[model samples]
Target: MPKSKVRKKTVYTPPSSDRTTTPVKLAGPTHPVYIAVMLGMMLIGLAWLVVNYLAGNSIPFMATLGPWNFLIGFSLIVIGLLMTMRWR
Candidate 1:
């Protein structure tokens, strides 16, 4: 029987580049007000939609705004959702 040959493996090295030595500042915890505002926006948006659906024809402002009510509700919800990304 013939003896099998062993294969040699090369060590892997990462490519080096010009990286800054300065340490990055870590972000602090999100402020309580920020969390409140974020939650408030989402809740307000949902409430707005609910109000529009429930009393759009009866409420003067909602009736006047008409389709714009949807925009306001969705915009608030979107703003709140965007804020979540920055939440700690």
Candidate 2:
């Protein structure tokens, strides 16, 4: 019986030596209205904190949330930051 020959496997690769990069087309909110909305949110968060500090019970909803004031405020700021990142 004839001896069987082993076959070598080759992996496929890109022809270009340089690494390929896909163009990232990020859709950013360039609309002035949208930017204003984000700014409003950030300002609202700040105002809420300040009001809670200066005038107690000024913001009824803040009391309802209890210690989450920081959470809410920071979340609003973070959202604004995210919007800024996407803003063109």
Candidate 3:
């Protein structure tokens, strides 16, 4: 009598986890808060630009700040933009 050979198959098993993949949480300002801050900065920059444009020398304080007045306004905008990057 010839004995029949039988093939054995192994089943694949997946890893067990309590939870599935989830999105990574970012640490920073919320959307609305970030937007508000950004907008405020933009408005301030705009106001500074306007004030300086209108009065080139009348603002005595500007004379003390020198070229920093322009820098301050531009810096605010830059900071806002940087902050926006952190927004989630």
Query: In terms of TM-score, which candidate is strongest?
Result: 1
**Per-model C-alpha lDDT, please?**
0.97, 0.79, 0.80
The number of the candidate with the highest lDDT is 1
Note the clash tally of each candidate.
0, 0, 0
Please write out the lDDT profile of model 3 over residues 1-75, one tens digit for every residue: 999999899898887886788899867647786689888997888788777778847889876776788888898
Candidate 2 wrongly placed segments (more than 4 Å)? 1-29, 58-60
**Looking at candidate 3, what is the lDDT of residue 64?**
76
Candidate 1 vs candidate 3: the lDDT winner is 1
Order the candidates by lDDT, highest first. 1, 3, 2
Q: Give the C-alpha miss distance for residue 47 in model 1, angstroms.
A: 0.1
lDDT of 2 by residue, 1-88 (tens): 9999999999988698688888999885589998898899888888767776776356677678777877887788778877887667
Q: List the residue pairs that clash in candidate 1.
A: none
Model 1 lowest lDDT segment of ten? 15-24
